[model samples]
Target: MSSGSNSARRVASLLRPSIIDSGVCRSCQETIGRRSYATATPAATESTTTPPVVTPAYTINAGVVLSRPPQITRELEPFEKAFFFYQKRLNERLALPFTKYFYFKRGTPADEDWKKKIQERRTAARDIGKYNAYDSDAWNDELLLGAEQSEPANQVEALVQDAESTANATSQDTSKKEDIPRPYPRITEADQKNDQKSLNRLLSRTLYLLVQSKEGNWKFPTSPVETGETLRLAAERTLSESAGVNMNTWMVGYHPVGWHKFNAPRAKKGETAKPDASGSKVFFLKSRIMAGQADLSINTQNLKDFKWLAKEELPQYLNTQYYSNIKNMLADR
Candidate 1:
């Protein structure tokens, strides 16, 4: 072929448009629709020096350029694009100072009311503290000032002053008084023997076994009746307070009653054994579990370990030292 003809054919081939149906055209059409049309001229060259056609690295729509080209890199799904627009609008709204201010004080009035109430409460508490004096000198001064203002010559006034002075003196004396120590009861030899017999009888009585946890340890809830409270009440309260278990009904059986005394070497000097005081009372009381009485409050204050065991399993469940009582109780049952 002639050189001019060959050159003409090459230019024509490069200029010819690639065939594109609706689907392929739609992809490019969307980007073209959003951008301003530009006329780009093909450069003329004879030595095959064709300048590269620089297509957009990203898709453009309505003057908006995507960072990553949706058509070429990764096309965004409709939902994804919708989400992007939503996030874009959200960011734009957040940038506005008015929007920020509106949200900042949205519930501020209610919060302010709460803060005001708290301040008022604090003020009242301070006022109460101001009235309650801790210093003895301040209290005495107030009392004396009140007394001095009274008419001393009048008999009624003198009487009132005397009463006030007496009351003040009593108050001061009461504040100075030492805490009274509880005196241990004295047990005579006859009483001790009687108590021993009573204890033996108590031991022979039936007792319901219940385990409770206290201070990370397990302790049997047993007590002798003394002072004001009954044995049953004492046992129940001790169990409840220590192990969180409430004893409802007891199935008392034959239990041994015994009295045992030990001279505690740890007792302080001059601390003689008081007569009429029983060393210990051992008794058995039978009881049953009550529903809804199980303590669910988790506290290590009084107890730590706990379990309920049947009479048959008592030997295996309890330590060896506790077996004798369990065995006797079961035999009695």
Candidate 2:
């Protein structure tokens, strides 16, 4: 052995066993004059995650707004009559004047006949109390100062008598009379008797179908929504079930017109509330009854009665809050 190798062996034999027995490797630990040791490191921890929240479910219902559209025009009020008359006159003034020559040639037999008819027709202003002193005969009454025996007065009286006689003779002859078709009466026997169920009652105004449940509550036909059915489909089915399939009806649209939320029924004293008694929501769809009437006998919901009523008459039959919610959906006439 060389002298250097003998010195290295002497230093290793002098080191303590405690320094060599340390957990850290020899490369990690420093070889200071006083033996040094490595410190232990802590292990990493895993992160925790939070779960998602769930929403509560609500019961959905579909309802129908079955209505009978007005067949005849609604009666006009006196004010409305005057307003329409004024508007008609204003429109007439703005309209292009009729060209007489285009329809009837000048000085022909047809033109002569037209001129005679025009002379016999009285001005509309005479009936409505409208007159222009500068344009028309402002004094509608006959001349009071003129002698009754005047030749012109006698001629006018004769002409008037001849026209009256001809009109009277035509009216008296039954076989020569024109066969003019008259309209069905606005008021029916059902209307006279106040029969609520009859569809023929109100001819002029719009009529809504209101069904009375076995509990005596009046409402539009409605039913719970079934799985796999849309709101519109549910509404269609509900109407057929509640009002019967006899009526020919058409839904207005696929979307709902309005929605009303109903609260869960309150439990009585000493009674437990049902678990699935969550409040329901009703979405209404507008529909029109084109033909046939509601037959309550075949109603699956056990509806006791029904009515075809006008919008104005609904308040008398339905509750205030319920009526107010649906008032806008109903037609005025």
C-alpha-based local distance difference test score of model 1: 0.38
Candidate 1: which stretches are off by over 4 Å? 1-219, 223-226, 243-280, 296-301, 331-333
Worst 10 residues of 2 by lDDT: 125-134
Candidate 2 lDDT over residue span 168-287, tens digit each: 557967556344334456678988999988888788988999999999999999999999999999999999899999999999999988877778787999999776667778899999
lDDT agreement with native, every candidate: 0.38, 0.73
Can you give the TM-score per candidate against the true fold? Answer: 0.26, 0.59
Q: Which ten residues in a row have the lowest lDDT in candidate 1?
A: 61-70
Tell me the lDDT of candidate 2.
Answer: 0.73
RMSD of each: 39.5, 16.7
Best by TM-score: 2
